[model samples]
Target: MSQATCPQCHAPFTPGQRFCPNCGKQISSTGEGVIPTVAASNSSLPPTMAANSNEGLPPTMAAGSNPNLPPVGNSNPNLPPTMAAEDPANHQQPYSQYASGAYTPPPPPSYNGYPGGTPTPNDPYAPPPPPGPGMYSMPPIPPKKKNSLPWIIGAVVVVLVLAVCGGSLYGITQLFSKKSTDNKTQTTTDNNNNGDNSNDTATKSVTLTNLAISYATDQITFTSIEQADQFPDDTYTKTYSYEKKSNFVRIHMKEKQEGGRSAYFSYSSAFSLILPDKTTIKALNAGEFSGPKEGEQRENWVDFETKKPVDLNSLVLRLGTAEEAQMEFPLKSNADLSEYLPKQADLNKAFNYGPMKWTLNTAIQRYDAPGAQAKKGKVFVIVSLTASNPSSSDFWGYDYIRLKSGDTTAAPEYTSDDDDLNDLSAGASNVKGTLIFQVPPSDTYTLVFASGKNLSGTNVTFSIK
Candidate 1:
């Protein structure tokens, strides 16, 4: 808020001041000498500051009018004292700034060995200026976020691959080891068998119809394991329905007929799974089921558990029992049994035997229901027959007719539901029925009819297939 000083005398002056009081010089900061005007009326000032010098003035006759106010121009009483001289021929400092007068600017000063491009400093103690701004550029882009699902999936795939390779290697090792052990066991059994026949009991043949060796193995199935530290049951069932344990494993076996008889799986039976490390895991399910009959099957399940999953590679299922079991199908393999399954064969043929006209319909075998299924290595053959009794007397067909296959002969199965043709009354026409017989699968078969007492006098043979 301080005032500016005069450049001539260094005396302070206000903003609107037109002259320096101590030097008697006009100011040009008010733009006095910039505009053009008639020299007779122009009021102006000098460009450079001067204190006592009059070098810019020209020789004039009116000098001593008033020395204190610096000589007035031309002594023109009607004109202003600040106005320049009117004579165009005499163009000095103040008159040179007239409307028609010509003037020239002084040469610029030099600094730091270069031409003046920066402003001259008035305050010698001021600080230096700061450096200029830098060049323009664009902002940086942000990075994208990543998903974790693909990484998790890749990790899982790698784990599964490692597990499969390890399992396959373990299985191969166990297979070789099992073969070696079985060879040693067979050698020991042979040596023992040659010495005595009464030593072996549970694995000995009982009769011609029942043997001790393994036979028809049922579907052996297992379920995914469930692991827990606790269970909800005090006693475990064969199916592990209400029981649970750590590293639990359950296997289901159905219709396991051994040596033409059931395995006789009971609550007292001992079931186990042997591991590759010779560790045996005993079955936890000791629950009992009803015993199976002849030509039937025994269905059961075995459950085992341990504290940790160890030595579980290449397992072998085994069962042990008293002498009454007669059989046990352990360590079995999957085989194609499609040829043993019963199926129907269609046949339409007309023939005559004795007093009745007969039309043989079909011969089919089925195993869809219980007790109706054939035993292992055997099949059921039921032949449909349509008969017309034209005579007046009743005829019994069971006694006079017989079916034979290979070296085996079969009579009518009277206990079955297919015995309607065993007896035909008089005038009964187009009576259709079947004769059921259990037999083995064979291509050669014959049906025989006779017409004498006890069917022994005269007989007629009809080829079946």
Candidate 2:
């Protein structure tokens, strides 16, 4: 008379009953006749109760149970055709057949040729169907993303930026370089122009056309200029003597006043002579000359001496400290003397002055003289000259004459023992005299005559050999 519990609903029932009356699930019994306690509902059952219940249950019941199993006669048509034809109601015969002890449970259905043990009506342990071609699988993992495009874009942007910066830098450098080059070129051009201007300033030329002479505070007029190779007898050396003799270049000039006032000129410190070599020669002796009256012009002479002969074609005469010259003259030299002394026969001819005619008669060598003694290494030479004045004015014979042999020159000697051609008054017929010079005994000599004291007049030369 013990009770058994229905496994699906946990309802109590008599042990001899084949099924539970409340839920209509089948029940089983063993030969032991042991009663089975009613279990709590499976939803509320403790883990110990569930495990203990498995111990006493049959192997078919212990495997599993299914709550969604079809009823005994209601098999699913969606199952396999073979499984759908097997009726579960056929296995549930009346319980009176099981009471005879000869009834046995049906074998479990075979799944793919594997024998499943005897199955309970609603077994939960049915093996799942084998996987077919329609089974779901995880989506293919997405390919790893690539970053090549972004890197390329970034590199391109960087290159463009660098190009722009480099262009800007190049432009700036080129601008500065061009500016510096222009500045240097301008500086060089300015320096060259300055150099050219300086050269032009240093080298300047002026012509000598109608130049006026100046002395101190007075303005003078330059009339004429001449040159001679010797000094006059009474002017420089009174006796025939040996000294450093030089040639003379003379200037004939005059000064004028607005009114009748007289002007004085110092010949020595007043003027200077610039030779062709640009050397300046100052006057050795200082003397004064008087100016002319208001309308009448008086003549004055200034003399400059040089040890060597110069370019007689061009000479520069400067007065005081002036950078510009007072006068320039085209003087004459021995090369230009052929116009006056045409031939050697003309040396003794009467050459006409403005109001006088003069001639060189003869030259004689004298070894000794009465009272005039020649210096140790020297001898004397006598020259005869004649002068005639036909005009009303007096012919003054105070002129420079000399005898030249090579670079040596001797002035005339004034001696009381010889006939001297002094000043001839107006209406004088003719006068003759002999002039003497002490010189070294050479094979050749030249007698040079100066018409004026400054040695600047009609000059004549006679070769004496």
Candidate 3:
């Protein structure tokens, strides 16, 4: 009951039948010519057969050689025609289906009639299809992002802040130092100007313009006062101020040459300071004109206007030589001792004294303290003495006193017994005593005494001058 298809008669035949039942054409068992005739029906059969048949085989006889095959030119009756509505002639065409805008998905194309293989060697220009939506893919690579503006801005801000702070600090420091220097300069200028105004009385109401104070000593020898100027008025013009205090004007006269060298003189000249009221303050007398010498002397004159003895707050002095006109006064380095001490003895001693001792403060003894200044030759001294009384008798005796030159506790040029009235009525009365020492301008003097009994107190404390 084998079934087959007739080649020419288009009739069915039993199995092993070698003849066409309808056309009576001989049928060969080789089955080769039968495939060529079937493939001839349409050349597009190759693509269809190539699409579904096994790889690398003749499609016709392979698919149609079945014993229960249908007649030639017959389609599969069981399969719906719409399932493969695509024309088989479209096979072997390049992009024909896609170019037509058809929605049908093309089969996976191959070569050599094999699965997942290359194109046929016979086709020269055959290349694979272009990439599709899902066909082509690449590894995912995320984008890169970078930002540095914030850090850069912050660094700029920091630099600006530091610069501002440093500049501000430096400016403040400079400003303070400048103000201090200006203040000092202004003060010095004001003082010098005031002193200059006080110097010239004729220019009193003239509003003193030149503000320079000059000084010269009497020890220097020069032909003229104008030629003896060491510190010229042109060099230092800065002014100075004076405090409100009593001052006796001190004058130092000296002689020198115009070239700054000291000179010896055979005779001296008279000098004085003329005030605004035509009152003359005599500086040097003709008796003092023996030789070229330098001497410092102070005047105890009271201001005619103030009626108080001038305690030397400021002075305007001038010196004249035999040949030259005059020169401004110069400043001296000597300390003002009048304000410090008010006694003639103390002043003289300060100018001519030595080391001293302190019984109370041992360390202060080695140094000398000028005693005091006296007004109208009156001086005060504070002394201390210690004594013992061993006998029960009240003796009538007095203590001896000495006034020595200089500050040493040595033998003095003047001595006197204590002028105490005798009180001889008790069993040793211990009493404290104080004495006053008056001396002229000898420039050096001190009070001392020998140890004796009946020395009452440990100290003799009182003011002198």
Per-residue accuracy of model 2 over 11-58 as CA lDDT, tens digit each: 555554554454444454331222534343354556644443455453
Cα lDDT of model 3 by residue, 57-129, tens digit: 4222234444332324334333223223323343323124334653233233233222232343455677753
Inter-residue clash pairs, candidate 2: none
Model 2 off-target regions past 4 Å? 1-348, 416-420, 451-456
Instruction: Report the alpha-carbon TM-score of model 3 versus the true structure.
Output: 0.21
lDDT of 2 at 236: 44
Global lDDT scores for all candidate models: 0.47, 0.51, 0.34
lDDT of 1 by residue, 1-465 (tens): 344655644545554345644343455633332222311232354431222222343332123332423343354343223343344344344454534443222223222211122223653543443322452445668787798999999999999999999999999999999799667646644543353332332121111111122222222233222222323432453234344434554444444342233434453344566644667667666323533455554555445665444322234555433222222222323323343344565667777666667887777654212223344444556777788989888877556567776777777665344456767888888888767665555775667665665334323233333
Best by lDDT: 2
Kindly give the stretch of ten consecutive residues in candidate 2 with the minimal lDDT sum: 335-344
RMSD of 1: 17.0
Q: Which one wins on TM-score?
A: 1
Question: Of the candidates numbered 2 and 3, which has the greater lDDT value?
Answer: 2
| Positional deviation of residue 432's Cα in model 1 after best superposition, in angstroms | 2.9
lDDT of 2 at 97: 37
